[model samples]
Target: MKIGLYFGTFNPIHVGHLTIANHLAEHSDLDQVWFIVTPQSPFKKKSTLLDDHQRLEMVYRATKDYVKLRPSDIEFGLKQPNYTIDTLTYLFEKFPEHEFALIMGEDNLKSFHKWKNYELILENHSIYVYPRLSKGNVETQFSNHPKIFNISAPIMELSSTFIRKEIKAGRNVRPMLSDNVWHYIDEMNFYR
Candidate 1:
């Protein structure tokens, strides 16, 4: 199977995330897109992040209806300060029969070289990059590489940070989240 791993903290899965995943599943060569929920990212501050299980549950609630998209807790069992290279290596070893790729925004490609073993990732797997509205033009040295594909997926200016801020301010975020997720957030009083 050809699986595209869409890795993110997913503090709360929003419609923007769903739209990108759905677009990738429908437009790309990938058979499935797995939203690999990261418990913690080495590059991000943890103070603003929700609990790992809460984020994971929100991802599950948002993506449960899509057959082509799956919510993955693969990083939950792995060590904290998870690195993409280590996760990819582990996945390759565990699922030798399946082919894996990475799905990311063009903004990530701008700093791709900063990632650990980035060259190895490019050599072993493909990357499907979608545009992000806030990101400027990507000027990567690896632009010509065959494994890197630039896809024209819809760009949403929305972000999880904005959603969280809205919730904390007692503003409605219904349009930004799935119905299930919105209800859950309200019932659980999340981000408030």
Candidate 2:
């Protein structure tokens, strides 16, 4: 089976995120798309992250009913400084039968070179990149790289960052997140 690994903090999973997963699962070659909840991303600021298990539960609640979409805790068992290359390497060794691909936004593509062992990742796995419009995000050539494939998935203005800010301000985030997830967020007081 072909699987696409969509890694993120997912402070609180939302509709925009689900849409991307659904789009990939239905439209792409992927049989399933696992939303790997990263406990701590080496590239991101630690102050901005929610509790590890809490975030994971939110991800779980968000994707509970989607057959083609699932949540994973692979990074939770791994050591700190959750790097993509290391996670991918571990996944390769553990799930050899499944074809794995990296699913990331164009925003991440611009900073690909800064990642640890970026060349090794591009050299081995096929990367599925979705378009994004973050400031200063530029397009680069991945076709020249044999294992990368540039794809345009549904892009959204709703982001985990925006959702968090809304919650902190005591604003209604029901519109930002899925119904089930928003209920979980309210019950758990996630991001509060």
Q: What TM-score fits each model?
A: 0.97, 0.93
Worst 10 residues of 2 by lDDT: 136-145
User: lDDT tens string, model 2, 40-143?
Assistant: 88778878887888888888888888999999999999989878888988999999999888998877787788889998887778888777767752656554
Model 2 RMSD in Å is: 1.6
| Clash total of candidate 1 | 0
Clashes of each: 0, 0
Query: What shift in Å separates residue 151 of candidate 1 from its native position after superposition?
Result: 0.7
lDDT, residue 166, model 2: 88
Displacement of the residue 103 alpha carbon in candidate 1, Å: 0.7
lDDT of 1 at 34: 96
- Candidate 2 to truth, TM: 0.93
RMSD of 1: 1.0
